[model samples]
Target: MSDLVWTRGVEWLAAAASDPRACKRDWDRGEGIALLEAGRFWDVLSVPDQLGLLTLDLLWRPTLPVPGPTLVDTAAHRVGFFLPPDPDSKWIGAGLRHAGEGSWVAVPPPYRSTRFLEWLIPPDGTGELHSPTTLELALRQANGSLSVLAPLCGG
Candidate 1:
């Protein structure tokens, strides 16, 4: 189930973008998936309520490297989820960071801010697309449930 969840998340990320060229898989060794775009790195396979989204920039390097994923706890605190290099295990994490050229910002809770914009998942209870602020608010209100957070973020 973990592997499935992780894989699904990666798939969702690949599908989220209208331009397939924007999503590139640098590595997928059954242990985890590594995606890249515009020289930025996104390595976490995040499954929020069956919606998959990847975190970018935290693991950028010139060589193959594995950075731990972020995991939100029940207390709504964000932390890292490091996993051993195993093919059969799924590591869950919280608070995905958005990384770009020499700049990175930690995504706020999906229920509190609307700065994290996503083009994949639609807004909840409304047909309108999600804005970054709305997604952050949703994340804050989700109590660390990725299932709840992912949808609001358009994953």
Candidate 2:
């Protein structure tokens, strides 16, 4: 499964986006279906229960099949997700500086039942002010233009 998806979409994406991590192979070949990259896993998330975790960037929560189709069909697409290579991958910092640009996107709360924005990565990449996405700093590009990088894991 990993080899298949990685070859189809991730391969071209990795080169097009210039983010090899997105196409990195899971050599370990662990278990529980790889939802994204190497660490992200796909859990039986029937409903998005963790809205607080949402952010203006991208959301990659394990999702379970609703009520139709089958596991094989859903996993083929839903399970394998992707996002632009951001500060997390150590590429933005190496290429762009923080003062170049910034963007702010309002991350809608999951479950489609919330009335507030779970999180918002300020135009200057200050979304980490509330919760850090592992990067010590989030460098936003000028005029919110990343050239090719995607903001989050999901499209």
lDDT of 1 by residue, 77-143 (tens): 2232222223333333353433333332222222222223221221121112223333343334444
Each model's C-alpha lDDT? 0.32, 0.22
Top TM-score hit: 1
RMSD of 1: 17.5
**Could you tell me how far off, in angstroms, the CA of residue 146 lies in candidate 1 after the best superposition?**
16
Worst 10 contiguous positions by lDDT, candidate 1? 121-130
Badly placed stretches (over 4 Å) of model 1 are: 1-30, 38-97, 102-130, 139-155
lDDT measured at residue 3 in model 2 versus the true structure, 0 to 100:
45
Cα lDDT, model 1, residue 146: 50
Q: Deviation in angstroms for 93 in model 1?
A: 18
Model 2, total clashes: 7
| TM-score of structure candidate 2 | 0.17
**lDDT for 78 (candidate 1):** 29
